[model samples]
Target: MPRLPPVDRLDLDDLVHRYAVLVDQRAFTAVGELFTPDAELVLPDPPTSLRPTVEVRGRDAVIGALGRLTGFAATFHAVVGRVADADPGDPDRATGRVACEAHHVSVDEDGRARDLTWYLHYDDAYARIDDRWLIARRALSVDVIATGPVRKVRADG
Candidate 1:
């Protein structure tokens, strides 16, 4: 049990916010800088094109796995909410739930960008180490997704 630094509270918030922004923007390499050496990322139903239920361990593997998403040129949008719990023993260790709705878009043969939406929830574990806060693990629960003829455009409009 390590005493949390006074400034760590702010770091925790920034860490969560960064996750939302970086992931959506596909900043895979840059995102790596936010994590500790031994980080883990668990993605459930990561887009159809990617392997669903992927578990990435270690900083490099996590970053590499996320990097794969860029291949499709699709967006991995995340909407996070509420710091459910944080380990008081270690300000670097916390648990959170994030609500997310993801959408992927690409040009159809006709060259019109077709969009699809997915709804899911994220259960996260976070840890602070070396004066940096990082995601320890993330468990994703998929609620529903729109596919085939039911896909809708992203709200970015």
Candidate 2:
């Protein structure tokens, strides 16, 4: 397969980065704009505390599922690396893998807080629609989960 053009590669990278920023900001509404109308998002199942074996289909469903992130007091997603390649036979299609470190902070009723971090990667499929690249499918796989207590520091202090 021929490599994706420099511009296409950059656009794909921007798409992935945008997802991280939107999620961190809890801007679920804007996040939907990054996906195609029929996009799908698959999430892992298991020993992790996250919802298990979930598949969210379509743009609206994806946004709705992401809304669940509100359960966390705060969330941060950092994209560490990404690789994207154009389809061998079709320039309009592509695939990518993005590695990320995601942190979810939760506060207990007693005022204690904990941070649960997931070291994960997203396997993605992309499609060009009307000259713009959008995520068609994304599957998240968690490589590891680290949990620890956290102390909140006030900035004003």
Candidate 3:
């Protein structure tokens, strides 16, 4: 298959980066716009967390699932890298692997805060619809987790 067009490649890259930005901003509702109506998101069960593997289907469900991040005081997701290509027989379809580092901050009952970081990657399938690129399916795989106390510093505006 021919390489993905430069414009499509950039668009896919921007699409993934938008996910990181929206997630970090806790804009779960707006994030739904980046996905297809029937998109799916699959999350692995982390070794340190008791949560089972989670599979959410549909844009609404994906939004609801992302809202769980609100349990943390804050989260920062950095998109480290990504590689994507057009499907062999379909220019409107593509697949990619995106690496990310997600940091979650949580304050305990006594007011001490800690950071839990997950080094992970997403295997994504994308589809172009109505001249826009949207994630059709994404499966997250966590490679490592690190937890430590954090001394947060803030400045008043």
Candidate 4:
């Protein structure tokens, strides 16, 4: 067996951490900045519960989409598994996949609690810009989701 290169290990680890931080913190702006200019995020074929194929072009769109996702007020992301897979020919660019569990916290009018369950898979591309790794493309695949909390909703009078 041969030992992996140290630079490869560190970059891979940093890439993983960057992804974790953005998703965990609902930092879409940061997420959009993790890829290359021509990066493409492909959402694998799946069911309706999961989002269909969405191609987000350019950093602004990525940032916009993220804003909409985070506009709800509160969201939590928990990513599982290693995220360094799609190495883009060059060390400066790469692709990867990550499994994530998301907890959404929303407060409706009158301060009512609204919660939802989101199971997701993120396919991403990363590029090195200005000596920093950034996300270029990101596509989301949702496996299972519930619109309401575990408890049944009570009808309002």
Give the winner by TM-score: 1 or 2.
2
Determine which window of 10 residues in candidate 1 has minimal summed lDDT.
148-157
lDDT of 2 by residue, 1-157 (tens): 5689999999999999999999988889899989999999998875753433689899899999999898888888999999998899898999999999999988889989899999998999999999999999999988889999989923221
Best by lDDT: 2
Candidate 1 lDDT over 43-89, as tens digits, reads 76545623237777787887787776664436657664545565766
In model 2, which range of ten residues has the least summed lDDT? Answer: 44-53
lDDT of all the models against the reference? 0.67, 0.89, 0.88, 0.62
Error in Å for residue 121 of model 4: 1.0
Cα TM-score of candidate 3: 0.92
User: Global lDDT for candidate 2?
Assistant: 0.89
Candidate 4 lDDT trough over 10 residues, lowest sum: 148-157
Candidate numbers sorted by TM-score from highest down = 3, 2, 1, 4
lDDT for each residue of candidate 3 in 25-116, tens digit (9 for 90 to 100)? 88898899999999999887667542326899999999998998988888889999899988998889999999999998888889888899
Model 4: what TM-score? 0.68
Candidate 2 versus truth, CA RMSD in Å, comes to 2.6
